[model samples]
Target: MTSNLTDNTLDLDQAITSIKIWDQIRDAAQKSLRSEPVLEKMAHHIVLSSKDMAQGLGRLLSHQQPDTLVSREELEELFSFVAERAPQIITFAAADLEAVCERDPAATDFFVPFLYFKGFHAIQMHRFAYWLWQNGRQDMALFLQNRSSVLYGVDIHPAAKLGKRIVFDHATGIVIGETAVVEDDVSLFHGVTLGGTGKERKDRHPKVRQGAMVGAGSILLGNIEIGHHARVAAGSVVLKDVRAHATAAGSPAKEVRG
Candidate 1:
């Protein structure tokens, strides 16, 4: 039997009927169905059979989640519920796919991230978990958070705030603490950490502003601000605020070029 989308999803389906991204994915799926016989069944099940972007994405992500704890059908239902309620997630998810294709040279098209990239998968999972966390469904949210960590090797707290067009390049070993706030257009490389420094409870994580780029293996501790367009060099341990357009490096990261 087929699943049914809620009113909002149906409305959103109509709203995005002409959006190019959906057309791109559908076209790509059709091509893969014709060219790659091995993936034809999978592609048809995930993309061709679906009516819209949200439903297709929900099925795709849900296909990756769950290892006997929950069925794919159950996760798909939960994801559908999240999208119906928080339609901005659909917008952010589309922006995320665009960001990867635009920023990562290795990513060639929407089809790549939509089908294979773990970073893209992990981020969408967090968006759903974050929504659950916000709407008083913390237990289920944390369950999804754990699934994301185990599946993708990227751990972002359900309470951590994220923004649009965020790119996590080679995102393995990334950790975002409970209070961390990563703003729009931010790019974080593999092994990057937005972590707490000490024992004190409130607002302990770093706030990465819009257009900031944190390099691979870098760690930003405490509640410091990494300003707009700022750059944190690879392997640095930032302990202070980095002003806009500055580049921070070294163990106790200092502003090298402002």
Candidate 2:
């Protein structure tokens, strides 16, 4: 009985040491992944934004000094969330940017500027505003909304629903209307307006289909449906439904190609 007890104690000690070693390895990997060079290098500003937002919340809550590290499982869930609903934002910022740079020089020209954009500066700000909005701080949310516009030139209403992987490449002059539904893999170029056609009070503005690319300087007004895999050509003002796998171009845009 004495020998058995000694062996059990030794086993417990070994188990604890093994667990500690695994923990150190896990911490090192997560630290590497969460670094700016790793996370932000791919234009993964959204992931970086979420982490910053979480850190800000941690600070606001007075959780701990330097904040507690998020678990690997939790981090994976966040990345998967971005992958499922608004994948383009993550894909563009993460892997697509590199691929695009090699394939399309124009894409490189457009995306590089947004890498250092002040637009995403409000991502954490919006998180706070969103919390306020949820907690009946409508006025506070609106105030932050105004500040976001003034600072970022990217006006996303405090009440708007934004999914992951939604990239606002060159984010300038981009407006996300109050009732717009932007799905995953939706990519918006510079100066694109997703807005209401008139003074309609309901679900006005546009619904961007998944994997759809809205070209630069395009206006998608009213409750228009931009279909999946559809490309709204540059300078087009689309007021009507664009069919999937089609290209809409020209003023009062017409489908010129599929």
Candidate 3:
């Protein structure tokens, strides 16, 4: 028994070192199949049979679209295009997955969020659509945005720049406008809007710097900045720049004691 346990530990370590996140997620899905017999077919279809992380994510997101707007085959083709052209997205997705696991207490395993979390799904779709926008496919990008909003209730413009390790908790009603920029390690809760207060077209959106947390129902409007490591309290309406590492709250949010 001791020898068997030692061998298993070594094998597990080897697997972790050799395989990528996709493989880790697949292994988790397979294990879940045994424990969750009802999800066997879903797991097989979504994760087990997929060739790679990109393919699996593509299939999963595409499956959510209405058949009237875009067929699964067409969306899969677009997803493949983005995956092939911009491989860095896979890295971003891996980082985002790690972020969700680390930041969300409810997350137990990789497969849990990959299969069920709308936030993760919404962000991945935004990444793909962003790629499309960068490649001069504006209409297609907008189409994807529309579908994603309809499916997940998260509306993020493809042109909005988002960094890795972003946690969108309870992603519903989250709106990010076209000129918005959210840096790395940022956490946005439900009903958070990085939007414009007026109709001005040029750069009319908020810039959320690294390590910031925008609480639920908080609105950061116009060309203001939420500095690094800052925290905006829930339901606050921020109209101006927030200093780094500060905590801001209330309507037309003001920095309070940290």
Better candidate by lDDT, 1 or 3: 1
Tens digits of lDDT, candidate 2, 1-258: 001110112234433443443333334334546664554333232223333322222222221112236443443344343233322222223222333334344543422322333433444344445445555768856865776677677787766655434556666788888787776566777788999978678999798887788999999999888998799998899999999989999999999998
Q: In candidate 1, which residue pairs clash?
A: none
**lDDT tens per residue, model 1, 1-258:** 111111234336524632568779889988887888899878988888988888988999888865486999999999999988977787777878888989998887788788888988888899989889988999998998999999999999998989878899989999999999998889999999999998759999999998899999999999999999999999999999999999999998898899
Model 2 TM-score is 0.58
User: How many steric clashes between backbone atoms does each model show?
Assistant: 0, 9, 0
Best by lDDT: 1
Q: Which should have the higher lDDT, number 2 or number 3?
A: 3
Order of candidate numbers by lDDT, starting with the best: 1, 3, 2
Residue 226 of model 2 has an lDDT of 92
> For residues 1-258, what per-residue lDDT tens digits would candidate 3 score against the true structure?
001110112334333432477888998998998899998887888789988887888888887777775689898888988777676666677778889989999988777888899999998899888878887999999998988898999999999888878889999999999999898889999999999988678989999999999999999999999999999999999999999999999998999956
Q: lDDT of all predictions, in order shown?
A: 0.86, 0.56, 0.85
Q: Tell me, what's the RMSD of every candidate? A: 5.3, 14.5, 8.4
Q: Give the clashing pairs for model 3.
A: none
Candidate 1 C-alpha RMSD relative to the actual structure = 5.3
Q: List the residue pairs that clash in candidate 2.
A: 42-93, 43-93, 85-184, 86-164, 86-184, 88-185, 89-165, 89-166, 90-165
Worst 10 residues of 2 by lDDT: 1-10
Residue 234 alpha-carbon offset, candidate 2, angstroms: 1.2
